[model samples]
Target chain A: MMGISEYFESARIAYQAIIANKTRAFLTSLGIVIGIFFVIMMGWFLDGLDNAFDKTINAIGTDMLYVDKWSWGGSDDWRSVQKRKPISYQQALEASKKMTTAELVAPHASKWGGKITYQGNTLGSVSIVGVTAPFVNTPIGNLKEGRFFSETEDVHSVEVVILGYKVANAFFPDRSPLGEIMRINGRKFLVIGVVNKRGTIITDFIDNQVFIPIQTFMGMFGTARRGVQIAVKAGSQELLDEVREETRVIARQVRNLQPGEEDDFTINESQMFRDEISTLRLYVWGIGIGLTGLSFFVGIIGIMNIMFVSVTERTKEIGIRKALGAKNRSIMWQFLVESSTLCLFGAFIGFLLCATVIFAITSAFPDVDFLTPYVPLHLLFIASIVSIIVGIFAGLIPAYRASRLDPVEALRYE
Target chain B: MNNDIIINIEDVAKTYQMGAETVHALRSVSLQIRKNEYIAIMGPSGSGKSTMMNIVGCLDTPTKGTYLFENENVATMNDNELADIRNRKIGFVFQTFNLLARASTLKNVELPLVYAGVKKDERQQRAFAALESVGLQDRTHHKPNELSGGQRQRVAIARALVTKPSIILADEPTGNLDSKTGVEIMRLFGELWKNGNTVILVTHEEDIARHAHRIVRIRDGMIESDTINPSPAEV
Candidate 1:
């Protein structure tokens, strides 16, 4: 067995050899640096996406269900869904009257690509939603300024509207848009409230919309052409399944579908979104991990090449040490230590570079809640472990070759 | 004489395969070396003097017959055992003064003790003493490239002496130095031998071999003569 002192001597020799060829060591380790950087960045990106998804899902309400003619998951063929009868406001009213497990019910009608103007500024391609007062009770309904339209406003067809965050910002950059009158589809409507900024990467379109009472929307756009969506909030998270079944049965009865007949309405929930997001997450991780794996493989090859070159260059040194009473294990350890030390240097540089990039992004976009400011400690730990493993694998063949060298031939090598 | 013998060889042979032909590097040879004996092995190229030196140094196992080092059968020893024997019992000096090129003279001298698992402080102390014996105490901090050929050789000699081995085996120790520096190295070896250290010199030069008390000459893979110097040269 080689003693600890011998191992230390080997490490010292290995360090000297690396110091002697600083440029070669640095160049060889560059692959490792890039590999580690890509791995950590990829992890951070996926983690950010996950964080954004959680925030969006929570805001949308996990126990909420949307009753619509079309499924949000697109599981039903579009032609068949289009052929189904549109869900009408009357049907929504009937379903709400019959529901027992719902905490609140919001029946809404929305039109995309609508135009709104304030002063001389015109914002096109805005989503215009007509909803009841119960819509304000949802998580995304928190107001940043003023108040939501009241039930009296809906009954009287009052021209009061609530602007989403981005719309409010676009119309009034330096002041509040509440109580200000804005033209919607060429008619003057008072902005009663401003919804808080609730935009996430996956659900950003919600911030580009304005909401008004459903009666006013029917007076302007007419209710005969499009479908009405009924959003039902379960009394409790534990009652979501029961509420959904109740809504489904009520919606079928409102549509007057007989027993054994297929229901015309689709009930959508946050779980559908979660399932789709998870699949998307898998694809992201697969591609990200695959790409990082490729980079690490290339890094291994780079380190292996350098280790072979180092062994060949130091053949005489190996022979000298062997002749001076070094065992084969000692020679093997020397080369292994050299290669691993180089990889560790690369990992450290990679970590520093990654940290700088994260810091720059967080500093630049301080309000970007999706991007965490600091690299997670586990990422650093993983980078170190990955680098050490790469170093060992890369050095194995070359170190073995060095250890197996015949002392006589090595001593004679120039 | 039998009890004093530290190395014993009986009908040792070494063979090699060169492509399609078998080459007998050492056909058959037997020799014994006793304690504190200064001897030289002399031969031209291809005369198997290097093969003999390799066998004696425990760097290679003999293909046939028995060889003993202090009554231990070295021919049957495994690689680890042979390495241990070499580390503890024999010191090697090379013609090229094979010191680590990047290490200082002190580090070069400490190489053997490092392999021997000696503690750091004692290794340094003994290495320094060895360098002092070779009159290179002041040059211990210089790298091999910074030193003259003679000084590098002295450092190599210090490394060889640091282990306090049973025998100092030198292969053409002065072949790379000038005549004057070569004489200085030989004088140092003469003093080491006078201090009761066993020394073995492998060289082709008659002048360098004359510093040893006994001369063994080889020709065509066999010993041509083994004779005492009667009056060894005093360098």
Candidate 2:
């Protein structure tokens, strides 16, 4: 086995050679620098993407199941789903009462493009959602101020509303919005609560919505036309399948479907959304890895070419070392060390550049929290290990060629 | 003086194949060298003096002969074995000095010891001592390009002596230096010889050959004469 001292000696010689030819060494390392820079930045972007998706998915309750006429992720035959009977609020109320496994069942309905007005100030294109009191117990519903509508208000069809954070800020920027009366489509509604900022998940603008009691919404929008979505929360993760089965059975009975009859509603969970996100994530990863692989291949070829040149340039020096008692392995190790040092230098510069770019992007778009790139410690570790492996693979042939040179011929080389 | 034979060469021949024709570089040469002897192999260019030097230094194996270093046949040894012999038993000083141009004088002197796996502190101490013997201890930190030709040669000599090999083989040790510096280098060799090290000098210059106690003249791939110099030149 070669001693540690011998490796150090080889590294020392490699350092001297690099210092002696500064411009050559720098030029040779440029390819690796650029390649590693792209790889690290892409990795950081992917990390941020994963974090954003996870935050968005977690905001939608993981244990909750959505019962609706259509699947959460749209299916291929949407016309057939549209032809199926729209789920009604009565069926949701029936399922809530008949279900045995669900911890909470909240019925909800929505009307987009609604305008909310407080005196002369108007917030247009607002989403209006009608939900029961139990909707506040779900993950997506958290109050920053006041309280959600009571079960008495929901049953009595009281004109009570809960404002989203952004809506409240727009109408009453300097004062608390609780107890203020806001006009929703010319109907006076008392603001009983304010939803906390739930930042946009994919395309859903949760913070730009207003929530009202389902009975009041039915009075305004006419309950006979609109469909209601029933969100069922499982008591525990292990009971999710059982809760889903119970909800499906109750829904079927409410729809008066007999045995072997096709169901009129779709059962949805957060997992379906996660599966959709994963498909998109796989595409991003494929593109990122493909581009990174190409760049690394080019970088490795550049390193190999430069190492070959270095070996040829130092043929006479190799002969002198051999004459002084250097074994072939020592000569090989010297060249290998030189190449690896070059790669490490490039990787260091690449890391600095990547960090600078990430900093710039984050600072430039402070409002775009999802766009903030994250450089994890594991990514850095993997980058360094990859650089070393690339160095070894690129330097192998050139080092072997240097080691096999006949001392007599090499000494004679000019 | 102890008459212990250090190198024994018998009917050694070296041939090179050049495009279907074999060129005889050395034609059946036989020689023996002992400890503490200062001998010069003198010849013109292409006269096989270098081939003989390479064979004696264990850098190359002869084609058809028996060459022994301390009673071990060297012609049959592999490349790694030859390298070991060169590292531990024989040291070489080249015509051009051949010092690593970017390394310090101390680092150049420490090369052989590094290959021998010597610890850093001991390698440095022994390299310093070798430089001191060559009168170059003060120039230990200078690079080859920073030094004069004679100083570079001294550094090379220090490197050769650092390993404390049985024989010091120098091929035209003063070939690139001025006469005064050449005399200085020759006197350093004389000092090393007096200190009980075998010295083999290969040169074509008669004045340089006169510095040795014995001289062998070669021409046309054959030895023309081998004789002892009665009055060796003094430094």
All candidates: DockQ: 0.63, 0.76
The C-alpha stretches of model 2 lying farther than 4 A from their native spots are A172-175, A200-204, B1-3
Q: What TM-score would chain B receive for each of the candidates shown?
A: 0.98, 0.97
Candidate 1: residue B212 Cα off by (Å): 2.8
Interface RMSD of 1: 1.0
Question: TM-score of each candidate?
Answer: 0.89, 0.95
lDDT of candidate 2 at residue A388, scale 0 to 100: 80
For model 1 the TM-score comes to 0.89
* Model 1 lDDT, residue A206, Cα: 84
Question: A1-414, model 2: which lDDT tens digit per residue?
Answer: 676778998788778777887888777777778778877877787677677677776666678888988887775378888898888989889888998879999989988889998887888999899999999998767888899988999999999999987798888889998888999998999998998877544635777899999999988998787899998999667888899999899999999999998888998887776667778778877877787777778778888999899899999998988888888888889888888888877788788888888888988988776777455557677778888888888899999999998887888788
Where does model 1 exceed 4 Å of error?
A1-15, A26-34, A235-237, A275-302, A342-377, B1-4, B118-126, B194-196
Clashing pairs in 1: none
